[model samples]
Target chain A: LGLGLTASPLRAAGLEPNSFEDITSYNNYYEFGTGKDDPARYADQLTTDPWTIKIDGLVEKPGDYALSDLVPQMTIEERIYRFRCVEAWSMVVPWNGFELADLLELVGVKSGAKYVAFETVLRPEEMPGTRFPVLDWPYREGLRLDEARHPLTLLATGIYGKPMPNQNGAPIRLVVPWKYGFKYAKSISRITLTDQEPPTSWNMANAREYGFYSNVNPEVAHPRWSQATERRIGGGLFAKREPTLMFNGYDEVASLYQGMDLRKNF
Target chain B: MIDVVNRSVRAIPNWVLYVAGAVPVIWLYVLGFQNALGADPVDAIERNLGLWALWLLIAGLCITPLQRLTPLRLIKLRRPIGVVAFFYVLVHFLTWLVLDVQIPSQIVADIIKRPYVTVGMAALLLLLPLAVTSNNWSIRKMGARWRTVHKLVYPAVLLAGLHMVMQAKGFQLEPLVYLAAIAFLVAMRWMPLSSFRQAFVKR
Candidate 1:
């Protein structure tokens, strides 16, 4: 899946960068399996070469764009961000990618575009966990047009100065640092500029359990587990779980949800 | 055939089971030090201890039904199984308390709000008395009441299975298999399906 490497100078969140082993091995890629190591074990089957993302809906540039053609056009930057999972675990990842806003501008979003919908590659044969119906395949995530345009949002193509390992979403993926990790779809194959809120895969599977806007809110607990605390990935067995922060500690993004009810949207 | 196997099993000291049980726990810690538990070692440890606890609980519950149905006379192993299960449960609880939850307020709130945690805690609470009373002294003092008190194992086992099912992230077949095994063992005790029940009653 290694096409080429482009260096990014743009800095984002600051935390101790987790080891490449920790970032690659421990993941929540459901297409592989629920176990953290399942992705690293099974993701080799995923063919990321010759990938094309179909940009459609309310964009002027509505066509399939090969990832090779897209990479050279943008300035890739290294963004070290704190990634928090909805399951109450976290890792600090140094991602390599350009801003999503740059890509949206390149596509020339139409005036009617209110949301940005993303879809992951649906290759059930390659992704073994898809056979179990753990989730609706072709995992979908969305961002409000404003959130999509946020400077912090990244269209990550690599991590730790290398092309992203298949388990961590090779070729291209979305990285919304302010939201839970699931909000950033991996192995993304499609991006739709839409007028309505796109139906997210997890929300479609179980709406009450997984809300449309899965912001990291400590006050609103998952039905089965508390979101108040999260264990850091590389922390040893006796390490204490740190308290989870609202918006995952990117307080600058708090203004984006101003006057909105996170509890209701959560 | 049953008599031969039973005699052989009886020859082994019961403390052997305790030692055998400790092997996995020690092995897990060794693996932990070796970093063999994979990327997230803490979560892996939490899961490993919980799974072993659930498996041992099911195995402990299976003892009576197995002894009644066959010439196994395996009742002697039941106490060791329950005691080991209790140890695993204690470790699992501590892993969650000291490592997973961390904050005392959050732990209290999780026990109160989260159904999975509540169910797991209830199961642990139910198993406490059985583990405490596993000795011959308690058995002698309680008399007929000992049997009645130990019956709590049935409910505790079911709850442990339920906790596994609930704790699973999605539609996991492994936890469901554990639940099925528990259901089958429990049914063996109560369900008067036919000759199985008659044989059990005759025993």
Candidate 2:
């Protein structure tokens, strides 16, 4: 409790850089825009100031909370972890954010809020990809209430000692390091608590590839590819591929899914 | 140009051969920037290798048309260049099939179930016949049929290009250039002015 803002457990883990110039340069974020770096480029146009999240559906306090009023209510902390994608790739990122649980708690998730659906702002003038029907507009992502409340789950707002880059899902993005990258939605505008499981973008498009609970386990391969091993990027020509860890190197997190069958869930 | 270069002179100096041999090796060294070899090392390792394999394939596809037009006599260089192209692609597919997937049967299942993978495997299957027949013996035995046998390279090139496009979630311009070049080369095949016949007569 006596720890300084810079000396907290969150600071220690978050100190490590999650988003880098190189990583940001080679990103695949589609919310702010289509190109990998478009989020970083076009995301600055987003006015995080005076921003209000529309918390609706089954929430007891179903109303708008300004970015200022809401952010201070939630704990801002950092967590260091490897982010693995179902596409058989991974990244070791140190996130600068807080737990999703705290936000849900503050909003007072209703007893009937079994599922949580998140939405990103959709403006074709700024985000050209939104103009195209790439997926359902506003870029929707959903999580089961339990999954949303998982300790590993994060509500990231910034990276690398800076406000979130437009490319890196600036302002606010979810950091669920265990799931595939797409599961960690970016540029969030709305958070709706629902009685039934909400339809997610990826699962709706290809249910076989993405499941509601997309925890990173090697045994449960995507219908298109296995998740057994992954390459350590920038490892030279002679360097060998590394075996992919279950829960994307999060044994602490993997314990949460102990009773569940990943294969069936996948 | 072909007469001077392609002719096998037993007493010829070995340095020329070494220079030719070192092309791919030297190029790879240059590409491996500060020991970072593949694409976006910060990203997943598999993505880097996958991009590298596609780059090699693109380069290989470029060789055919470039040689036909260039005065540098690149014809003698085609087979070796192609073999290297195949090497990178082999590594690319192998990285996915072995390290990523880990089981051959799963890979087989994936190809069957996924249209993207099925298209890629089809391109690889088509490449097998070209690789097998890439010998002087096959060229001599097949004779005029050799042209018929090699014509498969056209579709092989096309499928390889499509494999890149299919795997991509969005439009990228680089793959389009490779596809365009391959299309241009295929168009040349239908020309009344054959590049092979034109190469023999110089201005």
Candidate 3:
């Protein structure tokens, strides 16, 4: 099961993980609010205990499984990943979780399944941002079957060896290292395997700016801002922006795109 | 009440506006040094400066309409408010240039390629001439042309509001409210005082 236990090239390259305060405080969880600090301020209202993820659609096992039952069966490991936001900011996070592939294998993916769709838990009363129509409610995200099965893909349960903070998607969250941070759905409640391509929230909001496959590529700039460079969070006011790498420096996932023109896909 | 307010307004000097304008900037610097701007200080600082400039621009625009609609008069302070707004705008641009986008080539490319940056730059350019001729000597020398030159604030404020709307992540209400406020203020310039009185009286 331990396929690539080798030390991450990102860590080997001397990329220090951001302070836990930086990771927890500065978040893009729109469920809490739009401001960077909104999640830190408001997400504590969420009730993550006794969580159950609803699993259905083209799976051999389809039911509401409690998070406690799932954790005992899976092998949880820590992955240090470089997280890049579509807003042109980056952070190195020490995430502790199991691979999405392991979870799919346990659930038993059906032959007809071509894509994996995920949904975030929406409680308008708890989530203050949901009161406003900032986005279509219940933030949705998806991945091709191949991308879902990739070893790098993770459903993170904790950060920095500690249980995940409510602000940073407590209990469970998706983490696709190569893709932009928006692609990773937080505080996930549902996982569905379907043959058809699923709609993503940001792409639905503004198709011009956010594409379905939001892989971090410096060459394809966001309509309103450049993606060529990214400011590292927690870097002081004077810190210079470093040039962004293709696929956020995880070159192994480059095979996922093969011959598809990223510019058009972006 | 109007006489008392006007007398108090007359007592205050224009230089006080410039001194008042420096307060926010100084406060931001102090907060920045203390690392009190949350996790992303650079972003917080950048946004705070931009918002200060926007608020000042809106306040400057309010001067004319305030004088026209009510008995209160602040026409004498308009020039100083505008000049201070320009100063804030200049500092906001510098923050983006020096702190946010440090790369020189990317800065130039952003100004040319990105629509929001282009609009913001255009607004800054429009405000430049107004700030330059804000002094009494230039106003005396230019005579009637001075009013014509200062009229550029209308388009500058419009562009600044548009820039704010364009740069926001989603369909945010804050920037939209700023845009709506600017539009209403600009529209007020065209309507006659008699129509404003009629509309108020009808209600």
Candidate 4:
């Protein structure tokens, strides 16, 4: 916070840059594939209009709802969110979407719903990434019972107005700003209230590399890179680089699991 | 083929060689001019050029081994490819050191502390001497010392591969493939012929 220009011209965290700008412009979370920017180039072809979200498992109402019918029923609000990438980068983007708690409520969570798991549509033809066992096809993410209902969580439909760019998880996506960017599963078609710790795309691949609660803690370094420092995009060479904040500037919003060894949990 | 080769004074097709080098520069200019790469053109430039540098280095390393086995005579392009790799790596280094982060202290800190940065800088540094002495005049002037100086390319390629490995999130297929190719190149050069013979027939 002491890094001068507190409310910097870059806009406070959680504000959307624009229709084209994103809090996370630098990452390999490609909608089309793992290669960075593959989604930007190829995701324009995705169809979001005729979309369906299936809500089942521990939910009381197990049924598929048309996206149009779904949107009107959900409450939409803009929340300034701090997005932390698995990479050390951090950004404060203003996100406009319905709180996920509202949606889970709409579906009516049953008594047994302890863990809420989100799923992305897996199509080899559309998402070439799912074609190979690159990750456990159909990317998956989950949250704790309390975390699911947390105010910070969101079921994002549109970003910067209009519609969510296919590259940025068109139709609908989830935003868990406190955790690593991958926690925000994109192109959501299914939501299951599971009793177990739901399998995630990254955790399934390498649990050590990517933990379930991948909060951006500088101490818990990613096996490959350190999380201590990050590059501020467009911050020309001369501009001082910013040190990564604990929990990606969400210590206020979500720093409960402190004191305990983060390295062990990580 | 022989007659046309004679018509062209140069042993290789000059225009194609020129096109090979011009492609990256022209592509970069088009991106830079249009402002299509984004607010930070330096990252785009660094990524695009760094990848090509690694690719060309790998490609250059494959030449002699391929020549030994195949009739392609890839050795001709080795020097050209080395020079291209060196140019791009210099660009990658410059974009980060000059355009993106101007502070020398931070850059030095990154090199001294960060594993990936250290490997990347080491690879770039290794390529510098090779770049400066790449010309025919230097080769003629240095004579036998040129061979000694050029041996640095092997370690440079390894360092580049290491840099990619460290930068990736997991066991990345791309970097792994590059490492495998390096392994194959090494195998072809150093593997005892008897190892291949035993694996092929004895049983």
- The TM-score leader among the candidates is 3
Instruction: Give a tens-digit lDDT track for model 2, residues A1-266.
Output: 46575456544542333336544654666655555556656666666666777889998788987877877877887666676656665555666888999988887887877889998777777776666565666677888888889888898987755677677776788988777788888878899999887788777766767788887778876655667776543334444555777777667766667797778887
Which lDDT value does model 4 have at A21?
Answer: 60
Please write out the lDDT profile of model 2 over residues B1-203, one tens digit for every residue: 55565465334455564466456544544565454443343233345544555565555556655555554445555565556556555655775665455556667778887777887778778777777787899999899998787777778778877776666553345556766866776677677556555766654
Question: Candidate 3's residue-wise lDDT over B29-67, tens digit each?
Answer: 789778888777888988888888899899999998878
Worst lDDT 10-window in candidate 4 chain B = B1-10
- Please list the residue runs of candidate 2 whose C-alpha ends up more than 4 Å from where it truly belongs after superposition: A1-19, A32-47, A234-239, A249-260, B1-29, B33-122, B128-141, B170-203
* Candidate 4 structure quality by residue, lDDT tens digits, A77-183: 87666666776555555667898898888888988778999899877677655555657667888988787888888988776555777877888989887788889
DockQ of each: 0.62, 0.20, 0.70, 0.26
In the predicted model 3, the residue pairs found to clash are: none
The worst-scoring run of ten residues by lDDT in candidate 4 chain A lies at A14-23
Candidate 3's residue-wise lDDT over A1-266, tens digit each? 24334445445674678999999989998889998889999999999998999999999999998999998898899998899999898988999999999999999999999999999999999999999888998899999999999999999999999998999998899999999999989999999999999999999899999998999999999988899999988877777799899999999998989999999998
Cα displacement (angstroms), candidate 1, residue A97, comes to 0.9
Where model 1 places Cα greater than 4 Å from the true spot, the runs are A1-14, B1-4, B33-36, B193-203
Give the candidate number with the greatest lDDT: 3
The Cα RMSD in angstroms, rounded to one decimal, for candidate 1 relative to the true structure is 4.4
For model 2, report DockQ: 0.20
Model 4: residue A58 alpha-carbon error in angstroms: 3.2
**Cα lDDT tens digits for candidate 4, B1-203:** 64454345347765577478768866885776576776455667777888888888888887776555444565667778888788888878887787655557766767777788888888888889999998889999999999989988888888888787777653457777887776676556567756655665665
Candidate order by DockQ, decreasing, is: 3, 1, 4, 2
List per-prediction Cα lDDT, in the order shown.
Answer: 0.87, 0.68, 0.91, 0.74
